[model samples]
Target: MPFSFPTGAARFVAATACALALTSLVGCSNGEGGGGDSTTESATSPSKSGGTQVTINDFKFQPASLTVSPGAKVTVVNNDTTTHTLTASKGGSFDTGDIDPGKSATFTAPSKPGDFPYTCTIHPLMKGTLTVE
Candidate 1:
């Protein structure tokens, strides 16, 4: 004898499972995780050492532009499926070689106030700006 779900229960269960799986995938796909809009800003509190965080999600940096105090430590977190790099556009200053998915890297902000632009060496089109105050 074989057992099975009642009526359309099996179909409903399968559909629900697929929906859930897609939901999870969507979050990693663009880093918004249902948060909506890739351009939205995501702020992080400064740590004891005056460190702050920037999230790399869905191929775009959350809070694409960040302003922090001089000498503050900025942590870059990769929440996407692929590896990413946060390299200074002009070289030197700070660079996170390669950050794997779900991984993170840290760098110190310039001690002087200025605008520092960065991009993913792997994905040149992915860009961000850091403002040191």
Candidate 2:
């Protein structure tokens, strides 16, 4: 092969670019921690008319159950050390992506007038539910 070598400066630039790309990819996880393999369905804003806040900390969900009016807004606050996602189960009315520690995720759902179970996609043991009337 012809004489070809990366100078120290060139190598540094290439390494920096690679590091940046990897960091970006690592931050794109759906709702899971590490890599870009997010397993949560992602949260969506509901067309409802109410508001509630759920805090995630101490490896548990605060106020595991909530009762709100039809068409309400729910805000999920993540205060844990790891990433956590707020996802609705069957007939789910909301889904929130990875909420980093000390961060929050908000989701608005249309008035459904019923009960909806939710949980953290990253930690299945952390679960909760919402009841709308």
The numbered model that scores best in TM-score is 1
TM-scores vs. true structure, each candidate: 0.65, 0.60
State the lDDT of candidate 1 residue by residue for 1-133, as single tens digits.
Answer: 9986655877889888888787566442334354555564535546445578888877888767888888888888899767999888985778999999999999888898898888888877677788887
- The true-structure Cα RMSD of candidate 1 reads 6.8
124: Cα error in model 2, Å = 0.6
Q: Encode model 2's per-residue lDDT on 43-99: one tens digit a residue.
A: 332323335777776666666777767776788888766788888877556889889
Model 1 Cα displacement at 39 (Å)? 6.7
Least accurate stretch of 10 residues (summed lDDT) in model 2? 38-47
Candidate 2 CA-lDDT value: 0.70
